[model samples]
Target: MQLPESQVAVLEAANADEATPVDALAAATDLPPETVTGAAFELEEQELVAVTERVDETISLTNEGRTYVEDGLPEVRLYEAALEASADADPAQMGQVIGTSGLEGDEVDIALSNYARKGYGSIDSGELTADPDADPAADPEATALESLVDEGTLEGSEDVLEQLERRGLAEVTESTVREVELTEQGVTELMAGVETAETVGQVTPELLTSGEWDEVEFAEYNVEADAETVEGGRVHVLREMSERVKDVLVGMGFEEMDGPHVDADFWINDCLFMPQDHPARTHWDRFALEQPTHIDDLPEDLVDAVERAHREGVGEDGEGYHSPWDEEFARALALRGHTTSLSTRYLSGEEIGEIEPPARFFSVEKAYRNDTLDATHLLEFYQIEGWVMAEDLSVRDLMGTFEEFYAQFGIEDIRFKPHYNPYTEPSFELFGTHPTTGELIEIGNSGIFREEMLEPLGVDCDVMAWGLALERLAMLTTGAEDIRDLHGTLADLEFLRNAEVTY
Candidate 1:
């Protein structure tokens, strides 16, 4: 019997008495593992060899995991600290115990989350208690990490490994391992004497010139063989969504706006009629700057106009906040919490030198805020700010515009609820039904710009504007349950690679 060189080599290397891994066969035949695997598959097709596949997983500790193995698990350290404070007898202050534990920032949260889950103790009302019976030294996860460090791998403890991976303390990789062994036909053929035959793997110019292409035996290809996955560079879902949003707005007759991310409070909140004492303007909510605290270049005339509007009023019937308004406070610089600052700059004719009626402007920009992180909220996010200046506008116009815009992305079930904003009168919040959860989520805020907000900006016509959450829009479009899955440190790479942004 005759066979291709690669196939004969693989078949001779494979043992009939025992199954050999593809790596071992490659070593014996002095061939590449991929080539040996392909040859094995081809021989299996001819019923001369049997090929079996199994998934092999490798586990390793991440840098964080290694640190824990050396120093100690965060939860274990917290437990030891609590015990030292006599927390096992009575609940001790969480702050004191945590301070003694030497855990800071994200490590504190990690310790708290795992401490209660491992039958360690209970945390209640700013207090922590340790379970005297619990043994921190015997924690399965810590044990697994130590074993991996010493032995380079683990035999069992799948559940513990999974928890470690979830906590970002470990990594697991899986690969398909193929094993080959000779069948009855292969052994019989080997005993009958097998010979190597000339086989062509590809069509060559010489073969064609010699007129031997028709008579040459071509090697069969195994289409079902396992191959390596190669990930190529592609546009991120957030960037793709941003471009699509710009295109949609431009198509709707809106010109893009641009401005500074860190600006004076004069344009960010003062021009919007927000009170200086408003809670949202406090350091707890806004990101205040340290160096170069105040802006050096605010238009003098515009500053006077805005200050008067804040203290006195906009018109005969307009009334002010009846509070102190200071130029020094307005000059303080900070990161803009929303993109409305751009609208103020454009409306005051300071950006492009004056404006006409019936003009449309929009901006898709980043905004910073000191917010508690959650599934829907992040520290910084993209805000889609827009405004329309015309003779007359109403709530009906704003709702219709939203309906038209959302329809482009296949979202039609939009709900509106009355809300409050300092700059817009008759303000309302926009809500959309979540595609996956079947629950309503707040998507944006919109209303007609009030007289107090517009008169100071030197705009005589009515303007309707809105600040929409770009991440919420993406959630409704992509059916993502968490905003972190789209972009963040904990973002899901597999989900991003496969997530499709329709429309």
Candidate 2:
């Protein structure tokens, strides 16, 4: 019987008496494990070999876990220190115990959190007490870590291993281990004798030069064979979504706008008609720059115009906040809470000169806010900002624009509720039903720019604008329940890798 070189090599290495793993076969046959695996599957299909597959989990200690094995686990060390300080009978100051434990920075917190959970001790207020009966030496997680160090793997310690993994002290990976053994047919074939066939796996330069390619037999590929999955570099889901948004907005006849991430409150809020004393302008909601506290290059005329609008009002009938408006406060720099600063800059001819009437502009940019992190909120996020400077713009135009924009992403059921924004009159929040949860999520805010905002920017025409959450738009499209899952320290890599940006 004649077989491809790889198949013949695999057959010669595989044993009838014992199953040999693909790695062992690869070593014996001098072929890649994947090649051996593919050959084994082909032999199995031909009834020449039996291939058995099982998932094998590999356990290994991380750098931190190794350190714990050498210096003792943080919690264990803390307990020992507490006991030495007579904490078993009475509470000891946490700082003193931690200092004695030699734990610093994040390790101190790690020790404290796990100490209570593992029955090592109780941490009350600012004190720590060691449990006299607690045995740090017999700690399952510590024992598991030691076992991994000694034996290079673990068994019957799933719970402990999981705990260690959660603590970022250990790593566990699963791989499909395939073992091949000769079947009755394979044994018979070996007895009958098999020969290696000269089959070309790929076209070579020598073969082409010699004009022997036509005469050579090509090896048939096993397309069904399990191959290694390679997770090559890919554009992040958020970045991809941002680019897609740019494309959509560009298609909708809007030119992209660019500006500073850190800008003067003058353009960010003052130009938007937000009073200096507005709650949203406070340090609690906005990130203020410390070193270069104030912006030096604010346009003078625009600053005066905005200040007048803030203090005295925009038109004859327009009413100001009557609040104390200070140029010094307006010049204070902060990480932009929104990308409306770009709109203000552009409208006032401070950015790319004055954008004339009937012009459309948009920006997909980062905005920093000291927001309470939650399922729907993040500290910093991409805001899809846009504005239309045209004649007689209205709420209908803003609503229709949002409807068209979201519809492109397959979200047709957009609902709007009247909301308030200091910059825009008749402001409303945009909501879209989450595909997975079916709950209406606040996706964006939109309204026509109020006279107080526009007149200062030297814009005589009507303007409708919005600052949409790019992450929320992604959630609506990708069905991610938590905004953190999109991007952050707790980002779900598995979800991001598989998430498809619909539309």
Candidate 3:
């Protein structure tokens, strides 16, 4: 092959310096190392240079790489070995490396392998590892602790702790008993409110077309008339849903249940009858929090029943979950993606345990996912969750409550199709007709809690659970085509402000 100008330059440079490493070549040439390495590689491939070797058949060439010698066109050397050794490098790095390794011929490739191993780390299929021969390190528990501290989720740092002791949000921590507090700045931030004002003089007509106002601070320059702007003055839509869901429960004479969103994997998954080895427990499926609260006090009776269920399917010990359900794995912490968090929440209330005939509870909050953001998917979105606990609660009871509930929204023709949710037996995936679109939309899922799920919550009765995407509901009601259209707007917020909040 006829050598290109860049190629000839690299071949000449290679002969000038014989033993220098690729890294040094990158600097010496004043070029990105990848460029030099690249051209040099081309020269070697054409029988110009020779290469040498390492542990595996990794080697360099033997002759002057792409030799431009005594004759006009020169005796070109195509050193296959040298080119092969540096094959993984970017074109620029290859050119520089070949130039620096001043080997007279193709032997430069041997030097390139040495270049990568030392400066670039271990080469695996041409990729670099920080420390190749060693196993990658898993995150240390302390790293998670540090993250929680950074996020202001955890308390303790002796100096900070001591200062917090005396002050509240700004408390001076002198003792171990630091009050959990938020600063006035933090309070304003957490309560979600902010105010700003701006007034800017219009630029002269000449300035307008020239972008003269680009860097202007309109807020600081306002004249006589005062104007103000305020934002974040409301609870999140998800939070609003939670309140509405709670109202639905309270109106039915049910009290709220409280549980931390930071509970361990055991309560979130295992206690709820999820198998430890199930795919949902994997990192891809759920958002595992750095510092999670572990539910240590598993009600013994429920624990035994679940253990039996797992050891044997629904009934017999035969064909049941075989492996030992790991207790440690169960205690892992993660964000509560489902309002089923309400399950443990209700269990914590004595009234739930003492309730006579009928009891209902609900929760609404954001569920997370790894889905890509699009018209129909989001990493986070709102879920409206509700459930009722009672004896012999027929599927009819379940349909009746839904009747009253969906009626409030003016939606009709509610129907359920058989579905399987891991925690619910006789489950349902709800479908509703889009009032305007006339298209059938599957909105949510519901089912009476399976024996496996209820056993963990200490509930012996049939507990029915149902959930739907609040965002989807909003999208339908607001005539939105995209999922993102649902919120963070003045109109949407105003709608919530004015919407009927029926009990």
Candidate 4:
């Protein structure tokens, strides 16, 4: 029975013999376009008026198109030039004709090619000639262009529109326009007249202070209407996964190891028995630092031992690599390629207290590699590294550890294949079948630390170590098909918001 002033005004203007566009209605009512739009929508919702929308495609000239209209289309110019020439004029090369037409680059080829296709001209051996009946003044395209310039739109076949679009002569765009008209019910309601009341959407301080709030009626709200989303605070999913991994490792009696992301290659590679000339130690695989190019804190004694291991084999019956060893390369600063570097640091006893026999150490930390990004691999990612130091560890112990480790995450089907690593002997690569792809994806690398690798670190016991992918684990556990979907810019916000963290 009661309507706002804006709604009543819009309804009155729309009560016409024919539907009127929103803009026209606004003009007739002397109301702002935006105000008229809102009022029209409200009236429609009340079934007092009907609103219909139409989508129109309009063509307009771009900067280059305007220039063509001022001069002439490339094909048209070429055709005119050919027509003005002598009937028996020397056959003009397509290029020369286009050049005479003032068209160059892609426009030259476009003009010559389309001239023949449009039946306006013919091209012979590198020559161009106009059709005897060709006339630029009567060209349909020229007429279409003139019409577009005057009316700002073209009513033509799809082929005509596509031709102009392909030649970069015009741009086509779509616009949606709405029209409003009163319904039969609206006419009846208007005849009875509309009455408005002082209704409050919110109680203002002035109204409360003046004690006038109780005298006015408040508009009823549609509680079921959609509201803005409010996201509550929670730890990031990656951080939560990190915490869960830490809990699993700790539960398995593994003491967590922590170290710097940037470190000397001495501990990361040299102490791990990696040859100085190894490809992975090169710039392509390692991120070498510019500032502070070399770390000076490496222990002198440890450096000497690692240097000897590279120059000379570890134990009896060994032939070390004959390649030259450079101490500077060993001391070069770089981002750690794997958290196994931390394992090397801890086993060396420089940090995380002294490494004793029967030691179980693991590091769930970030590592940087000079890697190309893809659906699965990231340049920087979390690596799950763990090492167990015992009197005499075997490959069986390594397999068992992985079994129990993945078991915590409900991954039971794990298989290992013999593989090779620079630091670990009897090496094996861990694999798990992808749930979606059904392909066996490599999870990580593991093997027993060779004497050459352990001796330099001052660890006399047999050490079994493994480096696994944390992202792959997250993907498997959380049903993420793409590893990138778990983190980084490409991650889906909707998926992150609704993704339930698996225990």
Indicate which candidate wins on lDDT.
1
What order do you get sorting by lDDT, best first?
1, 2, 4, 3
**lDDT against true structure, model 2:** 0.87
Clashes of each: 0, 0, 62, 0
Candidate 4 colliding pairs: none
What TM-score should be assigned to candidate 3?
0.48
For model 4, how does the per-residue alpha-carbon lDDT over 1-503 read when each residue is reduced to its tens digit?
A: 78877778888888557888988988988988767777787777888998888998778987777877787777887787776563225566665565567777656655655687678767776676677776678766776777788887675677787656655567787866889889988888989988765567788999899999989887545443223458877666677788888899999999988899999898788888888888888888889999999988778888888888888888897678878898888889999998887988899888866767888989899999976455577889999999999987899999999999999888999998999788889999989988766878888999999999888888898999999998888777777666767777556555577765567
Cα lDDT over the full model 3: 0.51
**Would you estimate the TM-scores of all the predictions?**
0.80, 0.72, 0.48, 0.65
Q: Which of the numbered candidates is closest to the native, going by highest TM-score?
A: 1
Each model's lDDT comes to: 0.90, 0.87, 0.51, 0.80
lDDT for residue 389 in candidate 1, whole number 0-100 = 96
Clash list (residue pairs), candidate 1: none
So what's the TM-score on candidate 2? 0.72
lDDT per residue (tens digit) for residues 271-316 in model 3: 5667777877788778887643455665556556666666665634
Cα RMSD for candidates in order: 5.0, 7.2, 27.7, 13.6
